[model samples]
Target: MTIDAKTPEEYISKVPEDRKEAISKLRETIKTNLPYGFEECINYGMIGYVVPHSLYPDGYHCDPKQPLPFACIASQKNFVALYHSGVYADPKIHDWFVAEYPKYVKTKLDMGKSCIRFKNIQTIPYELIGELCRKMTAQEWINLYEQNIKKS
Candidate 1:
């Protein structure tokens, strides 16, 4: 599902009707728990939370024009996905989320480097996602990205 949306609200409006509520809730959860300094916008065609350029002028190493992305939520064709850069960059957070997942959802965890796919939207663990959002602040993400992701 490629949604050509200029804003987060537009993205949400374009998602499948069945997924609107879940995506909205997921967006809300991320927004409510994400630490201060992260701004919400449409990034990479998804609802993205990023560290604004004002905070990190260098921006994303891959694309200096864009802000430093922290997290994103999107409704895909088969599932709704949550992408958290911290989980991919930090082993401790990855291990913690992996161990804690079974406690929340019965379905087997569907995850990639940073993408967590929820095939059953009803099974999406909003609370755990919120906690994950709160795990890293913007400055911390900038530090981690510099050390682990950004190339010299």
Candidate 2:
């Protein structure tokens, strides 16, 4: 995915035309499903929905300003990836996710510490993704972020 962001708007603008539409869709999904006390910004060269420090003073990875523990959407050369740090840290969440969203597994999926990757927009289970986002409360996210930080 292309991050290349100097600013949020610029980041969106920089996305290739073929992937921009998918990114736009993901952006809308994130906005519609976001939890309270989160902010949207361009981070790590992509669209990042952030749980700001004010909400979690310890912040992501306990670095305060670093990480930001985001749900990041990116348009990559090979695929689009949805980054959810909090979700990746919890085995129960991960297992439940696969069980709940079988359609996603049917698609081209990749795993990273916090990334869910797809070859294209058609593979994205937007509704389910939204549900997952909605289910992740701020407290759960902060706790997960802290846990992940300590592990790192």
Candidate 3:
């Protein structure tokens, strides 16, 4: 669903009723565990955590006007998605998550480069997500982004 929300609360309010609680919990989990320096906002139409321009004035390479995105949570039509740039950029973190996922949820991991899809809302592993949020700090993400993602 395309939600044109200006704030995180507004974004949650626009999601499907069934997904509201899960999204809210996921938001809280991310907020509670994410390292300092990342700000929460509505980014790419989803509730996102980003490295503010104050910390990384260069901003996102794709759109310099925007902050450097670290993670995001979206309630899609078929599933709820958690997008973590760290997992996509760091192979160690990726392998760790992949190895740890089966212990938390019975279903096979459904993931893309950065997007982890939770088709069954009840199966969403909030704790694992929280731990993932803490795996990389804003400065660490900025370094990784510069080395692996941002083009010259």
Candidate 4:
């Protein structure tokens, strides 16, 4: 969780032993459902999927040297988190998730603008999560990100 990891394996390995299974399982789900053209790697100290520099030369708006981030999974001290940039950047996406979550999940949702926190792995809705991961292609995300940035 320290953002010191240089690789996905390293990032996962650094998670506390008790949280490893949940972390790995969630990671697997994300990887399996993630859209194409987005590359996986360690970014900002978490296991991140990014739009590679070759695809987006502008990089991250805040840090041009880095690839534009799409999503990330991390095990924090109190909870495991899934960060999807799309849900925050696009209102329609955010609304879709919010509206659809209750239909798929029985437990109360614990989420922020871009992160969904899970304290209990059993309560996590893997199917809905995967759908969110696959909702848009890499190019679609780029356009959405750019549109949001311009509006800002």
Candidate 5:
């Protein structure tokens, strides 16, 4: 589904009322942990925190102007998703998350290439989540994600 959100406020407005608080809280958490140079914006139907294409002029992930670095927080019909760049390349972190997350959440965590679909804010392991946020930079994440793409 294409979420036509022009601003973050608009994006939050689109989310169901029950999910808004959790989404907002997660948004705060992500914003607090992001490294320097990353910016939050609306992209591809979700709340995408990105490294603007303008900042990395040489190209994104080795291709000039090709891709941007992003961490997304998305609201779905049934749950919210936290899309972070760390998941694709860091086996240790991925393993930690997979193992520990279920303990905190009531519902299952759904995953995609780099997306973590979760039910609500209460399910998050704040410390580990914060660590994941602090560990990745736009360039580092872009490199890792690119490697995964190549491997796949």
Candidate 6:
């Protein structure tokens, strides 16, 4: 889905009302632990947490004009997803999340490498999600990305 909203509030407002609370809670949890320098905006049709252009002048490696993506919350057709760049870039972080999740959430994790899909909003482990969101800063992400590129 193409995100037409220009601002985070506008994006949030456009979300299905049934999902507003869960998305809002997820947004808030992310914000609470998000390090300074990352900004929340509407990106790729979702509420995206990003490393603003001001901080990373080059922007995303794939698209220099666009800000680097860090994380995001999206209301998809079938589920709500929380996308975390940290987990995608760092295997240790992904492992930590996988090992820690079962302790906090009873439902099986519906996750890919980076996207955690919540088929049922009530199944989300809010605290664990917040901590995962808190795990990296913009600089840390940039460093990790650079390291990966170098290894490539």
Error at 102, model 3, angstroms: 0.2
Q: Estimate each model's TM-score.
A: 0.98, 0.84, 0.98, 0.92, 0.78, 0.94
Q: Between 1 and 3, whose lDDT is larger?
A: 3
- Model 6 whole-model lDDT (C-alpha atoms): 0.87
Candidate 6 minimal-lDDT segment of 10 residues: 143-152
How well does candidate 2 score on lDDT at residue 111? 68
Clashing pairs in 2: 1-75, 1-76, 3-45
Residue-wise C-alpha lDDT for candidate 1, range 2-114, written one tens digit per residue: 68999999998899999999999999999999999999999999999999999999999889999999899998889999999999999999999999999999989999999
Candidates 1 and 4: which is better by TM-score? 1
Candidate 6 wrongly placed segments (more than 4 Å): 149-152
Model 6, TM vs. native: 0.94
Tens-digit per-residue lDDT, 1-152, candidate 4: 56578888887778988888887888888889988889999888888999999999989988889999999999887888999998988888899999999997777888998998998877778888888998888999999888876334
Candidate 2: global Cα-lDDT? 0.74
Candidate 1 residue-wise lDDT at 72: 90
Whole-structure CA lDDT of model 1: 0.93
Better by TM-score, candidate 6 or 4: 6
lDDT of each residue in 58-111, candidate 6, tens digit only: 788888788988898998988999999899989999999999999998888889
List clashing residue pairs in candidate 1.
none
The Cα local distance difference test for each model comes to 0.93, 0.74, 0.94, 0.87, 0.73, 0.87
lDDT tens readout by residue for model 5, 59-129: 44445444375678888766678877677568876787788767766577778867887755567666667
Summed over model 2, clashes come to 3
Candidate 3 collision pairs: none
How does model 1 score by TM-score? 0.98
Give the clash total for candidate 6.
1
Please report, as a residue range, the 10-residue window in candidate 2 with the lowest summed lDDT: 58-67
